[model samples]
Target: MNQPESSKSLFLGGAAKATAASREKYVPRMGEESALEEVLVEDVAPVRISAFVGLLVAISSFTAAVAKPMLVLPVLAIALCLFALRKHDGRTKPVGTLAARIGLVLACLFGSTGFFVHHLKSRTLGNQAVYFARQYLELAARGEESLAIELQKTKPNRQVATMQLNEAYSQDESAMEQLENFRSGAYVDVKKAGLDTEWELDRRPRVFQKYGREKVDTYWRDPSGKFNGVIQVELEWSPAYEGEEADWHVSLFQVERELIVAPSVL
Candidate 1:
């Protein structure tokens, strides 16, 4: 009976030792797993934040491309994305970098395209303004008074007509006759002293301004290809009746003769 009890006690003691060894190994493994989980949780917040910021940058870039006025927003977004990317590391770095790059490319493309279109439109309008000015000046110089007057925003009033007549008849005895002819609503022949009726444009018209109104300057040359004078015309939008095509009409016309000075022999 004593021998059997000793053997059973030894066996129970060995089983206890094995159980303790297994617990020691399992506890360390559980602790290690918990630490790893804590590390992952700590990393998640930063990655999420970076991704969110990157999404915002992309959206702003797209908006900037569509609406040029919103370019500032995309610039700000790019700055923010860069800052976020700097803070990001490991798995999040690539995502943040990609977002920032995409935003930058889209912003550049849309912004440049918008500016180019705007400049092209301005150039086209300027060309139109210059053409209108040239046509008006051509008609006036050719003594097509009725056709030239049609280009005016409004018909010249009596006061304006009288002033023009006075300027045209400033010198010579025929001035009195021409003034009488103008008052009688007749086309006074001032071809000899007035603008050269046979002049043609010698160079591209210089556009001074293009907005609600436009001003254009053009140089003219006589039949001999000598620069005769400069013509400036101001144009404004004509009144649009319902369903009528939009148009511009001449608001003012001015001509300046080229100065002729004899060379002094030195």
Candidate 2:
């Protein structure tokens, strides 16, 4: 049977009102819960990239002894550590404080060591070797053979030029023969080259420190007959006990030896 239109309209209106009331009661609670969750969530701070990189750089800087270019890494690592510290705040905490500190210490130690080694090898020891070699050769050129040989003797036998002038070694045939064998052909020519011919320093072909002594291979040349010869000189340094400065003594001397250029002197 067909029902009345008015009755059906009344039923549908009641159902719509019930649906609207249910939505109004539950929607506000869901929105409030979402807002509360958003407030409770915390923000995480990011790790500073530089701090980690600085640590790595500091460790690699140990190679500065062999690779001179890496010596500058200490300064870089220190700067990075400082910058990392500056950016730290209540909200953004630095993550790797321990690593940064360790990096700083290592960088300083290796950096200083590298510089000291370079100075000793390039300047202090090299100068001592050349100075002793020059004095020894000059004596040989002037016919002071016995004293020249004495200069090359080890620490105990070597004598200073000024102190030994008064007391001379007894001149004899054996001494002359020894001089002839030690410094006869090329050695004599090299010594005499310094006297008459104007010579130029060809190069310092090698510099080495081994077994508690410094050794240098130096070459010299002149326009007179194109004199080219290699001389090897060794010097030992004695710590200052009696004098203000370290006592440097010539430990060994040789002429016409091969000059080999090694990549790593250390």
- The top-ranked prediction according to TM-score is 2
**Backbone clash count, each prediction separately:** 0, 0
Residue-level lDDT of model 1, residues 143-252, one tens digit each, is 75544544553433223443464344455356556344433431222233246555556576654455544455555445543334444466664445576656777765
Worst 10 residues of 2 by lDDT: 35-44
CA lDDT of each prediction against the hidden true structure = 0.54, 0.63
Off by over 4 Å in 2: 1-94, 98-102, 105-117, 159-180, 191-194, 241-245, 257-266
Q: How many backbone clashes are present in model 2?
A: 0
Q: What tens digits encode model 2's per-residue C-alpha lDDT throughout 95-148?
A: 777677777788788888887777666676666656766665566567666676
Q: Candidate 1, 131: how far from true, in Å? A: 2.4
TM-score of each: 0.46, 0.51
Stretch of 10 with least lDDT, candidate 1: 184-193
Whose lDDT is greatest here? 2
